[model samples]
Target: MRPFQCLIIVALFYCPLSAAIILTPTVMPLNIDKGGFAQFVITNNATATLPLEVSVHQLLFEPDGSYQSATEPAATLMVFPPAAMIHAGQKQAFRVQWSGVSDLPASQSFFVRFAHIQLTPATMPAGLRPSDTGVNIQINYNALLHVYSDRQRADIVLRVDDEGSARLTNLGDRFTYTNRLNFEAIDSEIQSQFETVVGDQFIAPYTTLVVDAGLTLPAGEYHGREIGF
Candidate 1:
């Protein structure tokens, strides 16, 4: 399998509109040893019943800080109830399980997408009138799924350049989840110290992340701390 690399911005929940469908716990982590199963909840807040379709894709990250996904129907992961009908103000639960090899060499990442299926006049619920004067909106959500083994480890190295920029490299076989990065700079002539912090980021195995520390200092010696995995 190819290594996945991306800068993941973690969010608590997804709700794009007032009457949109809500998905909770956007990040799902599964352990391969202990059954490798997890569940997520989806709540329908719209006025009409929602028809949803679920699909699984292998998440891929590009060097240009973009994301792409490829469908893997024959993969080890399984999603229960690939299609669902959730009534307004009702909640549905979906199950995801890893049924692949028992001994995974490294961690894997996937994106489980929940998309709204448009309702036609023939498919609309009984007594529900199709909106003719108002705009209809559809929202889709993608939740991150991380499958890992107990022996997974992340080796991240932080390097600072002379121009006050920073680079993070992950040499290990697992993904590194970093919340913050701290760096200190010293100005010899002014005898002053400066510190900068970078926001949350993810570094995948065998990938390098170039980021700005958000601080510019005179040419001087600088040091940084490796982000905790």
Candidate 2:
């Protein structure tokens, strides 16, 4: 099991991001039955105070193993402190609550965008020095969140793709994170044991990942499983 996980989706982002904000708990895992609530802390590291805007986007997993973002309606997910002005080195708490969400396909996931609200010059500190302006630019951060059905669990499916390449698919709801993958393949009389570091890759449910073995793995019986989360 990985202690922390992130996502790797190739898509055109509908929104922009800044670099001034840092979010703890980069990923959110929720139990749809347990009040469906999760929290994240936003910290501003810039020298100037930042006006922060918190928002959520529905993550649509496409067939080609990519994700598309759809803006979730404000009423769909209740977020507290949706807007706040955070001073440099200050922290603000935000909460996301999901209620009465049904008719979902086993489960669903979204991304929380910690966007930056431009700080007007008038809002800037009077004591700002020239160096300060150069150092404190707004940087935004994003966190992945998932709301799962009670049946949400991880199911790993592997298939041999091109030479030395394999495809890993998660057939269950929720993000299946693994620090290491144990699988083997062989070509000709040469056999090799290989491990792929999935990293913080949070593979969305019902999606497939083409894992490159970096070598020519022949067509043969390949076996392994996700060692842990």
Q: Give lDDT for model 1.
A: 0.63
Candidate 1 lDDT over 1-229, as tens digits, reads 3333332332223333323657876887788888899888888777777788887777665543345668654377888988899988899999988989988877777777776645565544445445752544344676788888878766655565677676666666676555533444444432122222444566655667675556455444334334443
Best by lDDT: 1
Candidate 2 has its poorest 10 consecutive residues by lDDT at 8-17
Q: How well does each candidate superpose onto the true structure, as a TM-score?
A: 0.71, 0.69
lDDT of 2 at 120: 57
lDDT of 2 at 28: 75
lDDT of 2 by residue, 1-229 (tens): 2112236221123222234456778777777677788999977776767787778877777644577667664456778988888887899999998864664556677777776644455544456444666644443467778778665666666666445566767776656654444554433333232333343455667777766545455554454355654
User: Model 1: C-alpha RMSD to truth?
Assistant: 6.2
Residue 92 of model 1, lDDT score? 95
- RMSD (Å) of each candidate, 1 decimal: 6.2, 6.7
